[model samples]
Target: MSAQTPEAPTVTTEERPAKERKVPRVVILGGGYVGFYTALRLRRRLGKREAAIVVVDPRSYMTYQPFLPEAAAGALEPRHVVVSHRRELKGVDTLTGRVTEIRHADRTVTITPTEGQPYDITYDHLVVALGSVARTLPIPGLAEQAIGFKQVEEAIALRNDVLNKLDTAASTWDPEARRRLLTFTFVGGGFAGIEAIAEVEDMARAAVGYYDSISPEDLRFVMIEGSARILPELGDEMGGYALEQLRKRNIEVHLSTFLSSCVDGHVVTSTGVEFDSATIVWTAGVKANPVLNSSDLPLDKMGRLNALPTLQVAHEDGTVVEGAWTAGDCAAVPDLANPGSYCSPSAQHAVRQARHLGDNLGRFLRSAEPTSYEHKHVGTVASLGLGKGVAQVYGIKLRGWPAWFMHRTYHMAQMPTFNRKVRIVLDWTLALLFRRELVALGRLHDPRADFRDASAAPRPKGAQKPADKAPQSEKVATPAP
Candidate 1:
């Protein structure tokens, strides 16, 4: 009677309070400049085991956006312009996934990978650096035909597409077809749009030398800006100078004009101008990644994350939201250098904000007060082509080759790791030694074309219809350059 069965090990509903992990998990969304630089700094600031840093992005590499125009113009190698996350971010977990939603109240994020089931990831701290997307208007065929200049892939595709169009123009005898192929329209007059149009125009002009029938004069490079001025960031004087420089290159700059529609290749603009063009580049503008709306974070009227000067997410009541941080194009961080103004969304602010954020995050993890983000922008520089550019550095305005040289030097000094810097410099050196590579690798986009063509060849008697449709490549019209 005394030998009672050993009481079954009692387990309470709240048994074994979930073991609190030893390391704080900090999650960063997006792998662009902000995310890349922040994670890179954090990797060095914290011990590998002290805090777990995870970076989630749809792209495995971060495209140095300032170099995108060069990449498109074939001045910089596409691969060198993009920094590989795995190669640069050591000891940090890299996730190739898109953050679908973030529930800050629950401290969890929903990540949908390129492949596989969606899963939730919990975090102690969150960094919202999910940058911006091409801001587009609701015009006909804009989404279907227009290409963006945001990513490296888009740059490569555009380069090929431009060259392909040139090839068509060279071979075609039809006036309408030649006109469409030779006409290239770019919308927006910001740094991105202007730089892209200028660089590509230079490339196209150079390429025409190789075509038998198409001449540089035959090509029409049109830029349609909605505002009354172009390069508004450069002030009225410099903006006017830029407009003059563009006109000298035969670039038609339409002020106070907006693209009305781009149905097929027929482009209509608010300026009462209509034209047919094979390629339409839309660098119009960018808005904060819509992913921010999926979270409960506070947003400004423009839909940018409301952030404090310290780079912490802020509440509507002007209070910091704890355990949250943001910078770059997504966050409207107060600009200490300019009173009553927020930092402009540019690489200068993005890089500096990242460094400050990483330092602050390290302090935050150690239960120390975080420092505020502050910086005076040094200058603005833009490359037009191989040896053409404009810059306003420390109030000193420069243009032509001198400005172009500064653009390269400034960006070269700032282009992430030393390896990348050296590689880019070497590329420039090689270009100086040899001729520019005008060969368009458009075939790269359709590598399986030969295989498909071989299989679709007229077979012997009675060829049955193929069970599965063979993948078709986008038809790229080639104009020699």
Candidate 2:
């Protein structure tokens, strides 16, 4: 080696090729309303040479959650209610993974992909939009038996499960079992709980016609609300109207009631009511995604990221954390329209906040002054069933078909992408022309179950079947040798 040293191959700093500057990368966490819209806006605002954008989420699509009730009711096709990120974010990179940790101090995030090893991605900017998850209580059997009504999958599963229960109930002869199967329980009385119970009950009632043994009277729909009223987002007047409408439809509305337990399909409530229900839906509420706790960001007492009205992550003193922005349910964004209050976690706020955050983020990248986000509450609308609804807009109240139409029109207009909008409109148009489909594809939840059963080891050739075998008592008693 000394002989082949060749003067140590001396090289100066100038001899090395200059290290190329990396294009600033913007890493967005989540693909919900905030993540998708921010990425889309950034792609349009920044050139390829200016910055690189990456969106990380476990799901590849953004679910239009407002229409989940309709989709579950078969008013709209399931596929039409979700938008594909890869299709929408043309110039941005989409990563189907979860952000395990965020080291904003180092400008890097750890992503755990569905498969493969975890990796760290360095970013010049970070967007926290992980959104919310079902806020479940520690009630007995909730984790084991109840299902949430958040994602499209859950909606579809609920639809199939309800229909399947109806099918089984129609074929069963046990009155108790039939009653249990026919009883459906919903926990919570917010918009989600009300809308979900209403839509699903509508579907089930219509489906009852297909089963000669089952009638609309046989179905029992129960709603349990811990609060003093349902649909509190709507004022007491509208809430009372909604309550009356649900009761008129034969739904049992339990105000100031809580689900005490639901062990083995036996539901016990705080109001001393008890029932056995085959289907239990938990739409109680939602909390910020817990993943935020893993990051070095400032969080409120409720675990949501502390966000300034400008959508930037900030300290309690209102000092902005450089290069970090957040919106949606995960962030405690101040409601500038309402002094001393924070924006409520609703789709209306989420969509508007995402757009505002996107604009502010773009301004940030371009070294421009950011503006505050402010939007007054417009109204609240809810679908009771296929043709029934309730709404309060700009201090005006609406009910019946007018409210239902408003619900559809507002959501359809707000849905992202023309492709999805057209598809959903077509779905509605077709729905108007035909009856709601009542088929239950229950196997969709466990598609491999049938295949696994079929692939099980076949009976050995010439092996005697259990039915073919002689009874132990009938077989001639042979004395052990």
Candidate 3:
């Protein structure tokens, strides 16, 4: 018999050891309050072997929106108001990209990076934290003329724009031109609008002292609200108090009014008032990020994710969508404390909901029962300007300095990290010791303009230089909405 080599053992596909299951990946969308907190919590509680964490957001940092007014008014360093995700969310993969579509049924999300081709990221668990955006109307010139107040960049641009306006108004001899440049109009009378106008007005009032031709009285601050009262969250009496205080500052408080048009710097209101305003700030309100419309997840009438008390995404039939969660301004979480009503979209609720959602998500991964999110809203507080504010806490009302102090204290405690808190405190201390920084860096808005001009091909001699483009002061730099 021919020497036959022992036949190699034939291993069937089924006999091979099953590939080790991959550690579950938790994908969090949006780096706002909920996304940041939830990722931080998961990384702390779960080891690498337990699960992998990934966060995707268009911005690498999270803006502490409550401090935006202070940032705009130069009371806080603009850098301090935003927390870097890469610095804070250690041990987690962070993708700076916009989530273009979410297919929860397939457990996959498509993210388009800031500069690259879109890609798909599959996750065992999905988190929808895509927060809100400025809710704007189709009013004429609004999209082209107004600036929003939702981010740090907008706040800084606004500060510069206001100062630039003052500069232009002071140098001009034309009364009409000066009036248009000095008029600052704010739409919406909610906390955001009220705080923004108050803070900027306060800053502008101080900045005007630098210009010999401008006085505080020469500056016009107008606030228009479609509702009858401002700060409605503070209740009728407190809202009334806020109204009176704003009026005392000589701010025009036009209640039951809406901005009908603002084309070419001309503003017309529903109440038939017309004026020319070079600066129009839109703080009207925020709506759930429109990206939700692209997702397969359940959403409420307001286009927000429908969430149960446990912060899990809920189906229309009332069953939870396993491994799916949501919170912050994007989620319509039922408010157990207020029956038949969902939690209000406020930083107060967003912070608490984020922490609670983080805890619940951690519990879910460990196969433990999730707890419902329940916290009575403590109250509402708003800063009118430096050394002035209004607050209503647990049915108690306060105004002026005491309220302002409380506003600072409460937000400081909730500003995210020790580093940020310390920096903000330093800013405040320095402000008390020195005058507010009144310099405007409007050029920051178009940093490349000069370079682009220099790079352009030299015009032919006698070309007239394109009619000597309008001066920066005469041009209104409309910020991102």
The TM-score of predicted model 3 comes to: 0.92
Name the regions of candidate 3 deviating beyond 4 angstroms: 1-21, 455-481
lDDT of 1 by residue, 92-131 (tens): 9999999999899999999999899999999999999999
Q: Which stretches of candidate 1 lie over 4 Å from their true place?
A: 1-21, 457-481
The per-prediction tally of clashing pairs is 8, 0, 0
Model 3 scores a C-alpha lDDT of 0.91
Pairs that collide in candidate 2 are none
lDDT of 2 by residue, 105-181 (tens): 99999999999999999999999999999999999999999999999999999999999999888766568999999
Tens digit per residue, CA lDDT, model 3, 143-196 = 888999999999999998999998777766678988899999999999999999
Error of 2 at 117 (Å): 1.7
Among all windows of 10 consecutive residues in model 2, the one with the lowest summed lDDT is 472-481
- TM for every model, in the order presented, reads 0.91, 0.91, 0.92
Model 3 lDDT at residue 412: 96
319 Cα displacement, candidate 1 (Å): 2.1
Residue 168, candidate 3: C-alpha displacement in angstroms = 1.4
- Where does the lowest 10-residue lDDT sum fall in candidate 1? 470-479
